[model samples]
Target chain A: MAWVLEDGRPIYAQLVERLQVQIVSGAYPPGGKLPSVRELAAVAAVNPNTMQKAFAELEKSGLIITQGTNGRVVTEDERLIRGSKRRLARRHADAYFAGMEGLGYTRAQAADFLRAAEGKGEAEDE
Target chain B: MNELIEIVGLTKAYDASHIAVNNVSLTLPRGKIIGLLGPNGSGKTTLIKMLNGLLTPTQGSIRIGGQPVGVETKAHVAYLPDRTYLSGNKKVTQILDFFCDFYADFSRERAVGMLQSLGVDPNARMGTLSKGTKEKVQLILVMSREADLYILDEPIAGVDPAARDYILRTILNNYDPNATVLISTHLIGDVEQVLDEVIFMRYGHLVLYTSVDNIRERHGKSVDAYFREVFAC
Candidate 1:
């Protein structure tokens, strides 16, 4: 995923969110070795110190673990991964609902819209 | 060991009317990519020159690694001036040789590798290359040195957007972790993400010096936005 960051938040906080999404979505597979702080910082075009800080935040939540000298890896725990995935999904859904509310759509209408869009997309694919 | 460069009450007065820098004091630790930011005529260049021992401070003192700025400190600092001082008649290879001869820490192989990657021809004359390419060559030369501190004055200002990214990447990937890189620039938005800390100057006075993330956290805006607010006319 593109590490597009906004202007209003801490860079490390943004990095933390991006890495969390990557881990949960299997872009960085469970048990997969994460790139070194320097490599990832170059890729993200951010300071390595900020990347290190983000990794520390992830390690605190058990989403990733740092080995003594071998570098860090995404958590291999299936349950932890699933929980993180669900939390991220819930956050997106909450944001969607809030946006739909601002557009004068009720929660039921929003759900129906999702159902309708999914069915229409399936029909078009067929 | 933590503090790589220290400045206390540093001031540079050109005359009674022109005070370029005034009573600035700060300590920069090693392993940080710090942004020296300010509007035009804010004494950013003057402060950098003083750090490089090119300009003597009228008041106060600067100690790099506990030693005053002189020959010893000069050997530890790699400076890239805002303007090009490389001779137009010299080929890229000759310039590389010059750096190798001048700085004991300069790595010719590393410079060559970087130049090849950037598709810069070593046989080409300095005057024949584009302004952006010249700046890239200068940056690569400076970065190839294994110095304790790198002072780059507006390294990215003369380059294009894509080249800016390359410069930032080069800075991120290169350099020793124990070395401190101090880059002075007005393009805050472009370099803010790459910077660990930033020192803001305003009309020869030190306005603020803080971590980049701290600015976003406290001001609820990016460093660029906050800078506009702080230095707005």
Candidate 2:
């Protein structure tokens, strides 16, 4: 997955978001090995210390764990994946509804939009 | 690994009574970029000179790669002094040849690439180049080496903002990861984001030596803001 950096936000926060998205999407499947700090820093074109800070933050949140010499690994805990997915879904719904309301759409109209979205999803699956 | 550069109770005095660098002890490890910061006449140059073996310390010792600062250490340390060190009559290609002959670690390809990218003609004499271009050439030479330690004093000083960024990027991209780089400059704000650690000097004394993260955590401010507060007149 591609990394996106939002303007004015701290780089570490963006890194955390990117990793979380990867974990929730199963890109970094359960027990997968994450890239080393030097590798990530080179890829991101950032300082190694900045990448280290991001890794430390991830470790603190229990999303990943590092083993000596073996490098960092994605945690296999299912609960973390479920929780992150729920949080992301809720945020998306909130933003969608807020935008619809700002554009003068009623609750009923928003529900209709969701039904239309379901139809499009089914069509794409078929 | 042992300290790549070590200074123990080091002091420097230009005159008999006036001290440039007070009693200071510091151990700088390899493979890290160190930012030596201070205001004007804060002994930053003197301290850097001692590290580069340009000036002998009045008291104490400086060891590089476990050996005392001498001809052996000098060979391993690439230094760019605060003031101009090259004569105007010499061409850029001549200096490059000189460095390659004198220092075993000088990389000719890297120097040529950097000079080309910087728009510095290799055949142009130092006297013919503009001040900013000259500074860029100096930086290119210093960073082209695969030395154990690289000491640069006021590398970006007197350059325009655009050239300053170019100089910083060159230093960042060119150096060997295992080499230690000590850059001494008063422009903290310009270089704070790239610094892993900072050494602040004041009135010939080491006022502070700490990581950028620790400083931010303690002061709730960026290193630039902390610097203004600490060095304000």
Candidate 3:
């Protein structure tokens, strides 16, 4: 999939978010080697330095580990991945509720709408 | 050694009445891609020409790798002007040969590879090629050099949207890690993501020099958006 980065935010931060989603979705499976900064930067058409900064952030959060000369790899810890997935889902839910609120729906009303949509199979899981 | 290019009180005057670049001082570090952005008649071209030693500065000084802008600096600086300067009568291979003979750092193999990939005919005269094709050839020659600094003026100006992506990627993958690349263009949105920092010029004066991310963080807008606000009429 093409990288979708929004304006008005730091590119490196957006790259970090994209990588997190990829890790949680098994697009970059646990223990898989990550592409080099130059390769990834070229693919995204962004500065390699910015891409490097994003990798450093991912390393700090323990989502990726550097193997010194062997390059970087996704963490092998399944629990950590699950935790990140849960956090991502919660963030999406929050955004959904916020949008619903902007449209004049209360929290309870938004929840009811979601349940009704699910019952009709209109909100199928990806 | 960290700062690859330094300008002190740089000024260029067209005559007694007009000043193109006015008392500008800047220090650019190595190993980064920087944008030199401004609107029309903002002196971006003047500053770039001075850096390449193509035009003389009326006052102040510019140093690349601690050497003043001169013949010595020219050898290490790969420059692509906004317009094509190659002779129209010459074949692409002849221009390639000229670059090979002129710049010791030029890579004939690399230029050939790029020309082949772009499907630019080397045996054809430069006059017969399309404007976009000519720009690609020029870019290939400039980027094939292993220089300390690369100054490109509106490198993406005439290219199509698809070719713009190719040009940006070429810059990203080719530049030496320790060298600095300074690109001057008014199309901020096209090159915003690739820039580490940007220098804004307005009315011959340096207005703002800051990181791309910093602009986004501080102003809650992209560099392109911020530029529009700052340069709005």
**Candidate with best DockQ:** 3
TM-score of chain A, model number 3: 0.92
Interface RMSD of 2: 4.3
Let me know the TM-score candidate 3 reaches against the reference structure.
0.97
Question: Against the true structure, what is every candidate's RMSD?
Answer: 2.6, 7.1, 2.3
Better of 1 and 2 by lDDT: 1
Q: Which pairs of residues have clashing backbones in candidate 1? A: none
**Which stretches of model 2 miss by more than 4 angstroms?**
A1-46, A56-126
Collision count for each candidate, in order: 0, 0, 0
What lDDT does candidate 3 reach at residue B141? Answer: 94
Provide the TM-score for each candidate, comma-separated.
0.95, 0.75, 0.97
Candidate chain B TM-scores, in order? 0.98, 0.96, 0.98
Candidate 3 regions exceeding 4 Å error are: A122-126
Minimum summed lDDT over a 10-residue window in model 3 chain B is located at B169-178
Model 2, C-alpha of A125: deviation from truth (Å): 44
Per-residue C-alpha lDDT of model 3 across residues A18-112, encoded as one tens digit per residue:
88999999999999999999889888888989999999999998999999999999999999999999999999999999998998989998898
lDDT of 1 by residue, A19-110 (tens): 98899889999999999988898889889999999999999999999998999999899899899889889999999899989988899888
For candidate 1, what is the lDDT? 0.93
